[model samples]
Target: MFEKVLIANRGEIALRIHRACREMGIHTVAVHSTADADAMHVRLADESVCIGPPSARDSYLNIPAILSAATITGADAIHPGIGFMAENAQFAEMVEEHGFTFIGPTPEHIRIMGDKVTAKRTVQSLGMPCVPGSDGPLDTVEDALATAKRIGYPVLIKAAAGGGGKGMKVALGPEQLREAYQLARGEARGAFGNDQVYMEKYLAKPRHIEIQVLADTHGNAVHFGERDCSVQRRHQKVVEEGPSPALNAEQRAHIGGIAANVVRELGYRGVGTIEFLFEDGQFYFIEMNTRLQVEHTVTEMITGIDLVREQIRVAAGAPLGYGQDAIRFQGHSIECRINAEHPDTFMPSPGRIDGYHAPGGLGVRVDSALYDGYRIPPHYDSLIAKLVVHGASRNECLMRLRRALEEFVIGGVETSLPLHRRIISEPDFINGSYDIHWLEHLLGLKG
Candidate 1:
């Protein structure tokens, strides 16, 4: 076990890693930007160091500064809590070269899976069902046209190295393809530094389901089941829940096994998620997230497994404590990503937090990095916290989440609480009959 570990990111994820380290008797060193000197994670950690300025390029995402902080603090391992350097394959290699453990998948796996084109090919090799589309990166409009022709109409163009719903465009016919192609390519290049785009058949009204998987260096892998993340705006997830209300028994097992098979084949380590789009009762692989996801707490709540501790233990060369059969998903769990924003228009609202009050009660768990006086930072993601609730059924879980959100209050900044209140009461959402397009349609109706 490592005596100390350095957290390489900020916000609630950083605090989550710090708490996990403390419970495991490991000292934690927090690296923060000049603007984050007084952040919650910095104050809670055992040691702290200022890495760089407020800009992400000079701060949270700066490799040299973080490495120096780890060296100065004598941390043998580094936990890239989320975002920024979490999925940087080259950075993972650098950490290893500096004799510090990167608490995630191997650099080889990260490099292979980070690129959506390469990831799809890898999964295709395993005989998994992938969306009918191009096998590699599409470089030009001509290449995209050919691929779209092969896949049929209503094609989707997406960034090869994209996540969080960025850099995506759909063209319903050939006439619209050229404009959508350039737009998606431009967005992809701006976001991932690679203009590589891929085309796929756009399945209508699909439910987004992802399986949570964990693997050890000892060749052991198991899945904790799936989460329904169809609730979203602009392709980013807002609300998520476990044991999707749409999945039948056989389909659940099949999807879970399909995800687990990929983990074993790729030799993936630590906590990861395999996302798939399910439409008309058929499933198609999308991509895999190479690090811990924001909705990880929902999986933990149902499975009673500390995913962070398991991630650390795997990095330390420890074997998995349980196998496939030993794992079980109990009850339904729901997570609402509470962000500081205008729920109606979904705009960012970062400012001082006054009269803050978080939801509390049985079955209510809030994963946040906030306080009564904490000022929400404008330089990063506007997400302030994740509110997760567990219950025996989906109805019970929704009720708990509704109550929790009602009890939640944060002044001085607009939040999505009112939006959630409306959604939770919507008849379609309550009946679990909504799809990925449902949220967007609701927005259009209000407009």
Candidate 2:
């Protein structure tokens, strides 16, 4: 076991990792920007370092500074709690090269899955279904046009190395393909420093489902069911639930097995998420997240597994303590991403939190680092907390979620709490029949 672990991110995720480390008797070192000196994670860590200013490029994303902090703190491992350099192949390689363990997949696996084009091809070769599109990256406008025509109208041009909805566009025909392709490439290059773009047949409405798989150095891998993340906006998930309401027992087992097999076949380690688009009762590969997801709480709630602790154990060369059959999943779980943003316009709202009160009840959990006087820095993402709930059934979970949302309180800055309440009250959402486009359609109707 690592004596000390340095967390390489901020906000709720950093705190989440810190809590996990404490439970395992591992000392934690928190690296933060100047603006986060008072951040909860920094306060709770055994030690801390002010890496740089508020800018992410100078702090959380600053590899040299983070490595230096880890070295000075004598950290045996670094846990990049999602975002920033979590999926960066170069970062992973550098960590290992510098003689420190990275609590994630191998650098090679990260590289393979980092590129959208290669990931799709690799998964397809493994017998995973994929949407029909360009076999590889399309280099020119003509190439994109040809691919779009072959794949039919409404094709999606996406960045090969992009996530969080950046570097993506939709074109219904040749007339719109050129601009869309160019824009996607430019955005991809700016966001990920890789302009390679690929095309895929767009599904008008599909549920975003993902399988969470965990592996260890001893060649054991297991999956903990699936999460339905269909309620989304701008290609970002807003609400997520476990044991997808859309899938039955057979389907869950089938997809979960496939996800686990992919990890075992590649000899991968740590925690990873395999995402898919579900339509017409069929699942198609989307992409793989090479780190712990923000919604991992819901999976843990349903499966009774602490993913962070498992991730740390795997990185330390420990074998999985349990097998597939030993794993048992319980009832339904839901997670609502509490962001500091306007409910209607979804604009970022960062400031000092005047009052804060988290709901408490059976099976309700709120993962946050916010305090009454804590100031939300504008330099980071708007997500401030995660409200997760679990119940015996999906219907009961929804009811608990509704009551919990109503009980949540925040002041000084607007939040998405109201929007979540409205969403939970809607018939389609309550019925668990919403798709990827459902949130956008709901907003459009309100407009």
| Model 2, residue 321: C-alpha shift (Å) | 2.0
Model 2 steric clash total: 0
Question: How much is the lDDT of residue 435 in candidate 2?
Answer: 90
- Tell me how many clashing residue pairs each candidate has: 0, 0
Report the Cα lDDT for candidate 2.
0.94
* Model 2: colliding residue pairs: none
Candidate 1 lDDT, tens digit per residue, 163-280?
8767899998877899999999899889889888899999978999999999998888889999999988878898898889899878988988988888988788998999999999
Off by over 4 Å in 1: 445-447
Off by over 4 Å in 2: 445-447
Q: Once model 2 is optimally superposed onto the true structure by TM-score, how far is the C-alpha of residue 176 displaced, in angstroms?
A: 1.8
Q: RMSD of each candidate? A: 1.3, 1.3
